[model samples]
Target: DAVYNILIDRWTKSSTPIHCIAHSLNPWYYSKEWINDVSGRVSPHKDMELSEERNKCLRRYFPDVKERRLVNQEFDRFSGGLDAFGSFDSLEDRWVLDPKAWWLVHGSSAPILQNLALKLLGQPCSSSCCERNWSTYSFIHSMRRNKISPKRAEDLVFLHTNLRLLSRNDADYKQRESKLWDIGGDAFDSFDNGAGVLEIASLSHDEPTMETMLFTDDED
Candidate 1:
């Protein structure tokens, strides 16, 4: 019901919290160990495949793992917010705030926002200010043919992701928001008994829905 509520009924919210939900993709959170940590029963749902997805998302996010991991890990260290969205929980576990949030947005974009909130925080913050400096730094560090020291590389990506998120000043943010609106309707009218159907389904796992991840954190 988590995915059902999210992709269906709850998607009607006024503000979508797609901030830095990158951490939700963290393989560790979906690992058998983490599942066991959060609940006693093992789930076939998020199993080992999460590691592959984590690596893929990270690769799209940064040029190098050592470089990417350094900055991402560091950013999270100073703040554990960004990793918030990618959780098995519909929302955080705070008393007052969590209850209210669960009552409202709940599983909606809660995790995504949590991730972005953490990534966005800094000594000083304003949506407009962070990205410019960050991009310049990334551009400089990622010069045509030079490898940045891991520390320096991290500093650069951290600044970029934090200060000037990839969509800073650009409408790419809105553009992306617009794109996701039609994810399900992109191709044909519906799935049918065709050979290609089998091939496509093989290409990806079952589409996630509320039922897909419905077990409580304790039930997992």
Candidate 2:
């Protein structure tokens, strides 16, 4: 119970109105089995916090009062499973397809809400991916390389990030014989040198010898 309470508190702090809106738009939340599977969790319509946040998001996105009202009316139909949303195909497809794809299929009836749902549902729920990009930025713009101009640093980071992304799709990235893949390490540029042999070789000239560093101990 304590662990659950901590997790719930953390989630509440991290969650935004967009998260609530995404939850409200997802069809699985309306499922009886899904609701029952998670204690204290309810459909968006029945969840006061979720409904409030959903309304807040709606107002922010659809600032026009009349347009917001239209979206809300459409939301009612969606939540109630009325009209096109209630069709056997859509109801069955709720579990069969991804949320964004499901919206793409049956969302023509509520075009406004559909567009909002597609955008919100497609977003990443966390900043981990962005943090990774920042990690690469830090590596490129390190203290040792502080003399590099911001524009040059930005360009290098962009080039490095895109290259890493493109390289992942190459066949050699996964081939053991190619030795191009980086299983794990502190260094991020290992992919350029097979098994990082070239990196180790380069570091030997500029930095302390690996053997001496490993064997030496500091007395504090």
Candidate 3:
């Protein structure tokens, strides 16, 4: 309790309590056990309050009977048996595994909670990616492209980002390559060579280069 208070005091002084709680909700770094411990020590009603807040948040998004029932069903599954998810005997292994993937596989019985967990756990702790995405949007919807409709611009950005993400995944890349090959042999060969070069370049350095050092200095 003393340690918890100390940490909470430090965090509160440096940042908002809500931000700290949100950060703690991230399952990749902290699990339910951690939440229970912190909340238990922080305040007797902390857990209940947090649960109520989460319920309210969900309700705001989904107020219909069907969605509410789904949420209730998910809660029932969770409360009925932790074993419903899987054996938590290997805590270290579970921690190392992606929380999103784990929830998808194990929480299939609780679809609503599975979806909720994925959404929460997948949230980045920082806004850097969002800022970069805005930069992408600006580049895509530049002065010359100002005439583009909002819907068209949105579609273009979505396709550009998602395609780049898909290309990073090996299975998706292979599938895309196969489709490209069917379209044209020369094009496929050119794509394969370019991809190979990029892969080699990405793997070329384990240590920081002079350029990286300069970038770090600039950031500092």
TM-score, every prediction = 0.22, 0.68, 0.44
lDDT against the true structure, per candidate, is 0.40, 0.76, 0.54
- The regions of model 3 sitting more than 4 angstroms off are 1-46, 79-83, 86-96, 136-220
Best by TM-score: 2
lDDT of 3 at 174: 37
Better of 1 and 3 by TM-score: 3
Q: Would you give me the overall lDDT of model 3?
A: 0.54
Candidate order by decreasing lDDT: 2, 3, 1
Write one digit per residue (lDDT tens) for candidate 3, span 159-220: 87787656544454335445322212344344246333332233324224523642454479
Model 1 lDDT tens row, 7-116: 76544442222212233422233334445666464332223443345445555656776777664564343234334434445323322242223324432334432343
1-220: candidate 2 lDDT, tens digit per residue:
9999999999997568888888999987776667788789778888888888988988998899999999999999999889999999888777778888999999899998899899888885556457666877898889899899989988998898788667756877654553333322444343355434443443444444532442242221
